[model samples]
Target: MRNKVTKAIFPVAGLGTRFLPATKSVPKEIMTLVDRPLVQYAIDEARAAGIKEFIFVTSRGKSALEDYFDEAPQLEQTLRKAGKTELLEILKSTNMDSGEIAYMRQHKALGLGHAVWCARRLVGNEPFAVMLPDDVIAAEKPCLQQMVEAYAETGGNMVAAMEVPSDKTNAYGILDIGEDMGAMVSVKGMVEKPKTGEAPSNLAVIGRYILHPNVLRNLNRIKAGAGGEIQLTDAIAAEIGTEKGVYGYRFRGQRFDCGSKAGFLQATVAFGLARDDLRDDLETYLHELLAARKAAE
Candidate 1:
């Protein structure tokens, strides 16, 4: 029987160079996505999927990220005294229980594989999930929850996948498919950021993953792959032909690559439109802006 995946690793060691001055003082995961921080969205998704423990692989300047989840007792008490019940309730959700979360610092600025491997001791021998806060996915059901449900049936290594234009395959880890199982595809191999005209397929692996513990064992080998950094794709691909199962789940969601400036702005707009309070106003403003641009053109 496959051990239930109850722990989740969040690789948030990135320095967020793209956000420049803003990230200069703040961790990118703490940046807001409409109203909530990127990490909060990820935490909510993991909690929805029955994740019992939250493990964060952080870097030096990320104390704020850790503190964000800590109880804001003084603030909560002030809100409670002011009769702001709704706000206080919202604040309460951010406080994680004492043992529910753990943090490990990634000393080097290594790649995603290294960041995940940093949490090895905490993950122990169980299969686990890895969610990158940068990939903010908005879905009817949270994206990770969908993948967790699928993991029960497939029971192997799973990565969230989405179809991209063939030309754009070079920008993502492209999947080499073995079998078509509707939304989930049996992954024969994963090629990391394949060169143009070298990609096998347009299905690209995004941030969500349900990885077996063996992958961490493979990461222990840790030979630097592409770009002289440990690549998670290389470790996951090692499980392809072995007993370790790896699959690509075509999750249903709108994924925003918050790591990039343009994707960040796009997510802000999309999320704003999705909100009942902001939709009408934002849509009206966007339409006027488009009309003005067209008139100028």
Candidate 2:
């Protein structure tokens, strides 16, 4: 029987150079979408997917990310004293029990692969999920939960996939598809950041992944590809043709790349619209801004 995927590794060691001045003080994962932090969204998704062990591969100056999950004693006490039960209930979700969450430091900013490799020991020998907080998925049933259900049938490695324009394939890891089952595609091959027109298919790999433990062993070779940093796709690709080959699960959701400024703003607006509390005000504000721009023009 396949062991239930209870553990998840979050690689949050990236130097948020894109949002530098803001990121200098706050880890990119702590940046709020509407009101909840980016990492909180990832954690909530993982929890929905039945993930019990949360492992965060972090780096220096990421204490805010760590403390975000820790207890807010004064605030909790204040909420209790003020009899704000609803607010306290929301705050309780942020606290992780001792040993439920583990943080490991990734000293070098090698790559996504290296950051994941840093959590190998914590993952041990089991199928685990990797959630990149930047790729926030706004879905009724969270993206990871969708993948976990698919994994129950096809017990191999699965990465979240979405259709990107052929021209934009170079920005993503293009999936060389074998058999298309509508939602899940059998992946024959995966090429990281393939050049334009050279991509096998338009389906591009996203940040979410449910990888087999063997991928960690493949990382031990430490061969660098694509920008001199170890590539997780390369390690996963090695398992092709072997038992339990890699697959791409075309999840049902809109994925926002919060890593880039444009994507961040887009997600902020998208998430704001999703909230009933903020929707009307936000929509009116955006309409007013657009109307002002038109008048100025």
Candidate 3:
């Protein structure tokens, strides 16, 4: 039997240079979309996928991110005293059990591959999942859970993939199609940020990944590719044509790239509209704003 994927690594060490002054003090992972922080969505999704070990690859200034998952005893007490049971329940969700989570400092701004490699000791020789907090997926079934189910059937290395427009292909890791298996595609090869119009296929690799232990071994020898960073795509691509080949899972979800300013705002609006309490009023405000822009136009 294949080892069940119970461990997940979250690479959250990036200096949120794009978000500037706000990120100067606060780790980007703690930035809120709706009421929950970005990392909370990732964590919740991992929990839904039955992940037990949460490994965070962090940097020096990410104490706030660490604190976000730590128990807020005083706040919980305050909520308890006020009889805010609903609010207290929400707080409980944020608290990670003592041994359930571990943090490893990357120290250097290397790359996704390097960040993941930092957790190799913790992961041991088992299959593990890597979730990028920036790529938030809104799905009826969490994206990782969907991938995990698929990974069970086809166990190798699986990445969450979605089709991108040809013009936008240059911005993503484009996959070369081997076999189109509807919801899942057998990956022929992976090219990290191929030149526009030169992409093998429009299927772009996203954040969620269920990787075999060998991929971590592959990362051990990978050199920096594309933008002078150790691209994770390279290590994964090396597994193509191996005994357990790589697969691209077309997960059922709407994904938002919260790493960018535009994507962050779009996710904010999308997530705000998703909340029943805020939906109607937020929709009305959005319509009003659009109408005002059109009138100006």
Best by lDDT: 3
How close is every model to the real structure, measured as TM-score? Answer: 0.98, 0.98, 0.98
Q: Which parts of model 2 are misplaced by more than 4 Å?
A: none
Q: Model 1, range 164-246, lDDT digits (tens) per residue? A: 99889999999999998989999998999999999989999999999999999999997988888899999999999887679
lDDT of 3 at 59: 93
lDDT of 3: 0.94
How many clashing residue pairs appear in each of the predictions shown? 0, 0, 0
lDDT per residue as tens, model 3, 11-68: 9999999999999999999988889999999999999999999999999999998888
Instruction: Kindly list the per-residue Cα lDDT of model 2 for residues 1-297, writing each as its tens digit.
Output: 888899999999998999989999999999998889999999999999999999999999999998999999999999999999999999998999999999999998888889899999999999999999999998889999999999999998999999999899999988899999999889889999998899999999998999999999999986889999999999889888789888899999999999999999999999999889999999999999999999999
**Alpha-carbon deviation at 102 in model 1, angstroms:** 0.7
List residue ranges in candidate 1 displaced over 4 A: none
The lDDT for every candidate, in the order shown, is: 0.93, 0.93, 0.94
What is the alpha-carbon RMSD of candidate 1 to the true structure? 1.0
